[model samples]
Target: MSKKQHRGWGVGEQAEQHYLVEPRHLAGGGDVRHVSEFLRAAGWTDQSRTGGPLVFDSPARTVHVAYNPFVRPGGWTITGKANDHEPEWNVTFNPQTPVEIVAGFTDALTKSRSAHAPNPWAPLRQHGWETERAQHFTAVSPDRNAWLQFHQTGEGQAHWWAGARTEHGRTWDAVLTPSTPMHLIEAFSAALADPQPVMRPRGNIPPSRWIRTTSVSVRPSELGAWQQARISAARAATWARNSWASSSPRTHTPTPRPYAAAAGAVRTGR
Candidate 1:
């Protein structure tokens, strides 16, 4: 059966798949600037789509690019659709990293250790959170070396999604919309065989105002970091050239809302 093109979102000519990555899992410890540069170098053009194939046009070649970030408090979230319709998920350093990060961030945000214990769902659910019902939960577990997995392998509204420790100890998380940390215990428990992973309702999820942190530019000694970024980007370009021999059928269109917040607005999960 052919998957229908989503209302406003575009779809590619070929079948769809999923991909995942974590900036932290890379050689650099999740340096946002470096990651962005690497992806751009990897044949990922900033071009948007209207209603057809999802092809990433870059200097080297055109390919599909789907990426997710794991800077959230709970387990990571995958929230992107690529040209070939592949969902982007990411790898992690360990199996238990999701569970551990989610638990720690949740506690810090809700309990309020200090100003640094910023609320994850602040701007979205400013008033507060309402527990829908009592649910079973597992203990927090965070192993640095793990492969965070994600797939639409579910029936009806339920889906099959999971992340486990990889042999090389690489953990990847998907950065979905309204990016925030998740409670891995809750996420894993939410994934059961029967009904499928309960699909999160579509809505406006905003980030907390307090979560915005700071960053310092690389000093003269930090030039090494830039050098590595260039290398990674070059490698990415090479990967893109080999991945897509032919471009998919695509349509050009504009996206209504660029992201949760505007240019000057505070960006979540930075």
Candidate 2:
């Protein structure tokens, strides 16, 4: 079969291009303060606002996300500290749920097929979507493949996920929204593509009315290592589940103050 050639430059690989809301940058230094102030004036608390890409108001321009060299420097610096400057801002998504609107834009802009298709290229997303890059949005699944393969196709620059918060001093600048919705779809798509088996059966007959049970045996010599690996995998899964669970926008749950509690204990000389 003839290979499918992309018509032009192909869809934007950047994840921010998929966000639904406009997550604009506030420049750096004073600009950060200004955007924070703007959100405050709009009745958003410092704890509620998020930092991310600056989706341009214009359509002709391809959306670009800014990266702070100090925070995440590219390539080896030859010598000296890797990244010296603290991260100024990142293309983060706000706590807004159901990234469908942004996803729609992403689907419109990008040429990425679902993660399951025959030609699966690595997903291109904002740098911080992975655990190592982001302060908050860590990879939920243990498989890094899902995080790596996901991409976003959207308009604007960034999004302000509503009701989201970050570990950075409860500042709105800490939380950010992805611009395109397609990035989320890509993440989910890649996750679905994982080699793990589905609990449901594929046969034409409906599932049995009752649950079935089976037993298996393993070599005693290998049991120790096997069990250890299983335990580790379980822990990873639990962490991923908890991470995304608490981030749900629909929950409206109050954030726990573990930091505050620790700080209070220290102050009281406990």
Candidate 3:
């Protein structure tokens, strides 16, 4: 009989692999009780409750929820592992995390574990952003004047951009990251619906207010013609101005030339 070689394989190694396979972070304000309830509802076993951090165990994972003294306004750090492994998965929730987002994370985590797949964007999708591609999505406000875009980073983090065009043709834009609270996104969406100007991040300029003015919405196919008409009008105005500027009193102001006729040519598609 051949002697069997003994290679040391242990629980710690399995735990490390499990954690490394799917790591996620969710940060903002949240309630511990809500988190605890969520864990219980997901069927995680209560392991240790006697001190430092509350512990929960799953068939192949361990979780710890503890108060983070270093975070302001008091926050909790939730960590997960395959089973007491090194380099555990961590997510922090601060005071700014809404209750709905906390619940959404729990649902996403549960789905990920059972499906054997990672879906970190579940919460965002639930909030009405339509996915365009993997980790990319766009949300347009009802008025069509404002839009929000989300782009996921290589590390599975998220980047956000919000833009709005005012009635006067001025544009406002902002770039934000996951570290910013979700409430800000909601606020931006609301501001886009109304006429109020959104404050830009870097400048001392005042907010851009929209004026109720006459506007025209041109179709993409008709844009060229509209542009040509505007160009003709500009040229006519320049010619009239130059003619008047170069003329003496004897010129009689060029007999009030037909400037509108030239502009009307393009508008009439002639």
Candidate 4:
């Protein structure tokens, strides 16, 4: 049996070649002209059309864009095939897809056609972060002081937050929404590995106290130490519980004393 290969979102991977755009995430309407314009700008040439889906071919792959007016918001379904004998690719797009998303998808597709490189998020995955779903991930930092979360927004934009645990078991959160540059993502990851104190808004502030001008520079090492302390305390508590549970019952049992007769009763008997 052959292993099923995992492909990135908006990309289709088959035996022969990779299909770049999945229309469902890119197109906004049934009109293929807009999409065609995007393709033409990207160096694709219109091969042929016969009153049906418009066919376009590029050096990398061939594509078919079909209109479906009956679909809600009028959308397009795109199919791609590699020149070599390979599996076909199909994707559907609704009219609700924003133009920016379409543009971003096209840019990504263009890049994929030329050369393949490791995704920017590859490092996060290497360090223990697991993608919970599309554009969302959760991970614990190496220092264990902070729990980090990642979210990718529309137009290739991305954001992340680090939650630092404090001595009182409180969490201090810092959010970073860097520009959608690949280099910036790389720098952010590097910063996490060797965290330094940086001024950030206090995470513990409530809505009422939000006006308070109290900001602090938090360090990754501090958060790690707090996490370690919490672990140590937990271990101590477990040990104490187990020690008490394993001790002999007699050691804790109360002793009973015999009572002497009252002095008055003794005197009367004498």
Candidate 2: which stretches are off by over 4 Å?
1-59, 71-90, 93-139, 143-179, 183-270
Q: Which candidate gets the maximum TM-score versus the true structure? A: 3
Evaluate all candidate structures by whole-model CA lDDT and list the values in order: 0.28, 0.25, 0.38, 0.38
Off by over 4 Å in 1: 1-31, 48-155, 160-233, 236-270
Ranking of all predicted structures according to lDDT, beginning with the best and ending with the worst = 3, 4, 1, 2
Model 1 earns a TM-score of 0.25
Shift in Å, residue 123, candidate 3: 7.0
For TM-score, candidate 1 versus 3, the one ahead is: 3
Separate clash counts for every candidate: 52, 37, 5, 5
Give the per-residue lDDT digits (tens) of candidate 4, residues 1-270: 111222332233222211111111111122244345555544566664565444566545655544445545554455556445544544443443323223333323332222344354555557654444545676665444445467666776656654444334423333445332343334344333322221112332222211112222223443344335433433343344346644433121111110111111111100
Q: After superposition, how far is residue 121 of candidate 3 from its true place, in Å?
A: 5.2
Model 3 per-residue lDDT at 51 = 52
Model 4's lDDT to the true fold? 0.38
Candidate 2 per-residue lDDT over residues 71-126, each given as its tens digit = 33221110011133322222332222112222222222212233443321233222
Q: Which stretches of candidate 3 lie over 4 Å from their true place?
A: 1-31, 41-61, 67-73, 82-88, 107-127, 130-270
- Model 3 lDDT per residue over 81-140, tens place: 534323345555443333233333433343222323333334334444344554667765
- Alpha-carbon lDDT of model 1: 0.28
